[model samples]
Target: MSGHSKWNNIKRKKEKTDGQKAKIFTKIGRELAMAVREGGSGDPAVNSRLKDAIAKAKANNVPNDNIDRIIKKASGEGNSDAYEAIQYEGYGPSGVAVIVETLTDNRNRTAGDLRHYFDKFGGNLGTTGCVSFMFQKKGVIVIEAEGLDEDEVMEAALEAGASDFQSDGDVFEIFTEPEDFSAIRDELAGKYTFVSADVEQVPDTYTAITDPDLIVKMGRLLEMLEDNDDVQSVWHNWENADDAE
Candidate 1:
């Protein structure tokens, strides 16, 4: 398995062990709020960014009522929460490039927490663009393979404007241009239940950490980033020894 799938495995375990579903709602809520401010509209029909956010929330199993409520509340007055989207780039143990995407109102607190986690776990947060160049932003959509024909899924995804498609025996992955993500996802939504559909930072390369000590520290570094409330998504290029083998 690739590191992305391995990390998704870790995330799945963590979410079930804790109340991470509620945390996911909060993160998507912040995204909806920010999308309204950035796009200056509550109607997803007119605001493409809001449309994408709504789709993402829905794909992740957020209730339609909650999505509507968040957008409506954000469009009204007296809502003082303005989330700024900031990305932190860094190098983890074994020089694995890490990029943390966050939506937060308090930059200082977020910065301090992220810095502390990196420093404590043998990683160092770097300046902007320090590690981002090693990555590319892409729209990735995943669908479970159970009770679904692989060929049908592949055909549908391709017909819906997906640039590439792959299956790992248990799930199908669909890739598209960032601009085509929303439309392609919407098209597939009519036919399949999405495992996840979002724009993600994909690393161009992977760094394999075979040393057991650095592997444990890297795991800690990832956990700290994942547990933070302000963190929306954590992207890295670290490959485990098992994957390397």
Candidate 2:
């Protein structure tokens, strides 16, 4: 499995915890709000961003009532939280390349929090393109593997314009060009259940922390970053990502 798929599998297990699920819902809700404000409409039919956000929220198993409420609030007047997307690139312990993406109303607070997490956890933040050059943005759709044949899923996904497909024991992962993700996911959704569907930063290279001490610090860094409400996503090619299972 690629880095993106592996990290997603880890998160899937974590979602079983109510606290973690609540955090996931909060993150998705923020994305939904941002989509509505930026896309200028709550109707997913006309707003591509909102449409994608709704699909992701559904894939994450968020309740429809919550989704409806978020959409209504986002589309109404006086929803004044204006979040701007910001990305921070840095290196974690053992020189693991890390990227933290955020939707923040206050840039300074988000940046400072991210910097502190990196510095206090044995890493250093860098300029905009420092580690981003090693990552690619792609659309990833994950489906539970239960009762599904890998070959069958591969064939259908290929026909629907997926760039790649893999069955990673617990889940079937489909990759697509960012532009094709929504269309392909919509096609697959008709016949299969999804674990998740989102556009994500995928790493081209992985950094392994062989030293046990570095691993501990790296893990803590990831936890702190993920716990931040402003942080939307964190991408890193940590070799032991599957260890989270």
Candidate 3:
């Protein structure tokens, strides 16, 4: 598995704890709110972004009741939070490419915190397009491979419009074109339970850091970024990212 997928699998395990789960719920809630406001509708039938956000929330095991409540609150007149979507590109230890996606009410505060994190952990935040050109946006869906037949899963994914299928010993990953991600995910949803279902930045190439000190700093950098309330997703190109463990 790639670093992005591997980290997500690790995060999935971590989210089994109440504290981590609550943090994930809060992050997804912000995403839901942004979808509703930007898409201009609470109804998933009419709002594609909202539909994708709800699917992502459900895949993360968010309750149906909570989903409905969030949509309702977000669309209500009483809700006035104006979150802006921002993308930050940077390099981690040994030039490990990193991309962070955030939704924040205060741009300055978010930028400062992120800058501080990078500097504290032996990395530096870069200009908007610095590392982004190294990645491609793809819809990635992960399903537990246990008790599942590889051939069958591969066939189903290909038939459902997945561009590629891969198994990383623990889970099956299905890749889809950005434009076709939602449709492919919906098609496979009826038959398979997802560990993760979302469009993500996928690195075209990967790098590794061998120095132990740099490895620790890289791990801390990622940890702080993920724990930030404004950060929704973090993608990286570290092949030996498991070293962070």
Candidate 4:
């Protein structure tokens, strides 16, 4: 993980086409709905999960109207979309550990599509615990670093319960234990704009694919998984993923 870059990943997502942006919006909407259901409240103040989901939606440029509408709908009766959270662990090319997180109403369809993608790209989907051992879940908060003072931000983050802080090229990454994520994020939100705020599966180590063919295949595998509507997040241990992007 020596060269891992979170800012680069944010830039890539921001540069995607409008169609892709729509998919992202849809995925976040699903997240909002789930948050409301799981938290049993539409009010972000009372429902921490819904508050965190709203922050993530805003960071991705989701409009206020859209966010409110989604929450209202999710809280209302007659909301029938029942999405189950599923995590699939596997290996990408060259033994790179991969984890795909999804929210799906139909497990059969999602599983089959993911299996095909992995197989076609020289990887294979494995059991639930197959590759998850290599990862730890943490809350990640990113703020743009254009004019912010790193020392000030780091101090505030640490004081607010963040466990780690790093300044990437164009963003500051603040990490916290999963349990402290919401509190820290809410504290920082009062003063700074977020680029992204969400709990994520972070890799413990990194792998690099030296073979050109495997590199190409690994890239495609990730793309396919990300493009799927059911997939909420994809985490991997590819150290050179910045180059692939």
The local lDDT score (0 to 100) that residue 113 gets in candidate 1 is 99
- Pick the winner on TM-score between candidates 2 and 3: 3
Give the true-structure RMSD of model 4: 1.7
* Clashes in predicted model 4: 0
What's the residue-level lDDT of 241 in candidate 4? 81
Model 4 weakest 10-residue run by lDDT: 1-10
Error of 4 at 132 (Å): 0.9
Give the per-residue lDDT digits (tens) of candidate 1, residues 127-207: 999999988888988888899999989999999999989887777889899999988988988899877778888778899
Please give each candidate's TM-score: 0.91, 0.93, 0.95, 0.95
Q: Which stretches of candidate 1 lie over 4 Å from their true place?
A: 1-7, 10-18, 241-245
Q: Each model's RMSD to truth, in Å?
A: 2.6, 1.9, 1.7, 1.7
Please provide, for model 4 over 1-245, each residue's C-alpha lDDT reduced to its tens digit, 9 standing for 90 to 100: 11274666777888999999999999999999999999999999999889888888888899999999999999999999899999998998999999999999999999999999999999999998988998999989889989999999999999999999998668889999999998898899999998888898888888989998898999889889999999999988898887777
Which should have the higher lDDT, number 2 or number 4?
4
lDDT of each: 0.84, 0.86, 0.89, 0.90
Q: What ranking of all candidate models by lDDT puts the best one first?
A: 4, 3, 2, 1
Report the number of the highest-lDDT candidate.
Answer: 4
Q: What is candidate 2's lDDT per residue for 1-245, written digit by digit as tens?
A: 24734646456555567887788899989999999999999999999999999988887788999999999999999988788999999999888888888999999999999999999989999989999999899998888888988999999999999999877687888999999999998999899987678888889988877877787888888878988999888888787855544
Q: Local error of candidate 3 at 228, Å?
A: 0.3
